[model samples]
Target: MASFAVLLRAVNIGPGLRVSSADLRGAADDAGLADARTLLNSGNLVVTPGSSGAGSAADVARLVEERLAERVGQDVSAVGLSAEQLDAIAAANPFPAAARDDPSHLQVHVPFGDLDEAGIARLDLASPGREMLATAAGVLYVHYVDGIGRSKLTPKVIDRAVGAPTTARNWNTITKLRAACAGLASR
Candidate 1:
């Protein structure tokens, strides 16, 4: 079985949507995933399933969407990452030191096929105290000198820049997710 890290988009945050980490694990289990675990309430999941192909990601996403939509009567979406890919993301981290002290630094994971120079240039990321821009790997890496909660660039802003579906985790969370994936693979 291949291991994957899945991030649900725009769910369990403010407003009416409320999905617990236990709910996420239960969804994975219902979808036939093995060794399912959740990182936090923000919808990060580490699951080992029989496959790691994008097709499998799509299936997990569709199942989760269907289940959540049934529960909340609203649509939801998800993005999945292979353990290898997550490891690559961790290795590709450019501002590890900055991220260590500053929880505002984040690694935004964008679909590899959805990145373009023109879209990135249109982000208008010139705000002071927060550095936000699209990276070569299609991920928008950001460092908010002030807390990200106070930063002008929200997750929506980053998504608009990439012009596609995206999910983000702080640098520390990314590293921990990477380790979890790696450990799962070793077993």
Candidate 2:
């Protein structure tokens, strides 16, 4: 069995799409994923496909989405990454200083599709702060130099700029998810 880090998009961020961590874990378990664990209420999950026959990360994501839809009565998009992929994303931290000094200001954006360069350029043009942006391994790393709350780089701006929906996790969350993936892989 291979472990995967599954990220659910746009859940628990607003009033209409609230899903508890327990519910998320139950959904994964019902989806035939083993060792299901949730990192936060924001829908970060780590699990292994036991007898689910999910051959790839994409398949795992699909299964999770289906289960979550059934449980929550609405569609929930998920992006899955294999253990190696998660580790690679963590290792590819472009803003190491930000991650070390101000982890909350460092965000890793995981897009549903490949990031568009033109859109990223548009985003760069729209940036109002000293935010640094980089893309590696199909993920975007952003360092909010001035802090995220006051920044104008909102979710809508990012979605418009990247031409794809993305879910962001701070450096602390990313590292925790990486460690969870490592633990799941070792089991």
Candidate 3:
């Protein structure tokens, strides 16, 4: 079976939609994914299923939405990734030096799509402490020297940029996810 890293979006950020890691693992297990492991509270899951090579990402996303709705009482959005995809995410880290040790720098992973120049320019991200729009391999890498919570480029900007949906993780979380994918591949 191939290794898969599922990045769940818009989960338990505040007090309202709280989903514990153990509960997330249980949901994955119930969905028939094997050896499911959760990385952190922000909904990063690494699972090895019996037929990981079988299903499409849309299928996985559907399964997660259905199960999480039942288990956590909320429909969660998930993005699935193979080992290779996760490796590419690691390699595609634009601000690698800043990402290594800085707590504020983050990587926003968006799917491959054609974002129009007009739409891209409409993003009013003139913040001083943050560097926006580092496009590499179809992924937008946003590095925030200041904390994301304080940044002006909120989730609304991201949603408009991809024109679909996007999820982000801090530099440390991205690094850990990459390492977990690598370890799973080695095994």
Whole-model lDDT per candidate: 0.68, 0.87, 0.69
Q: Work out the TM-score per prediction.
A: 0.82, 0.95, 0.83
lDDT (tens digit, per residue) of candidate 3 on 1-187: 4677778887878766777898788877778876778897888887766443336545555565567779977777787777776677668776777766674567665552454444554553544444556765555677776667787677776667657677777768766776786776567
Over the stretch 1-187, how does candidate 2's per-residue lDDT look in tens digits?
4889899998888686888898888888888888999997899999999878887888889999998889889989899999888888878888889989999999998889888877887788777688898888788888999988888888888887888999999999988988888888887
Q: What is the lDDT of residue 173 in candidate 2?
A: 92
Residue 173 in model 3: lDDT: 76
Candidate 1, residues 1-187, lDDT tens digits: the string is 4677887877776785777887787777667677778887888888777432324655556666666566556666777778777766666766676767775466555552466556656654455545655465446666666667787777666666667767777777887777887777778
Please list the residue runs of candidate 2 whose C-alpha ends up more than 4 Å from where it truly belongs after superposition. Answer: none
- 1 or 2, greater by TM-score: 2
User: What are the clashing pairs of model 3?
Assistant: none
Worst 10 residues of 1 by lDDT: 50-59
**Model 3 lDDT, residue 124, Cα:** 31
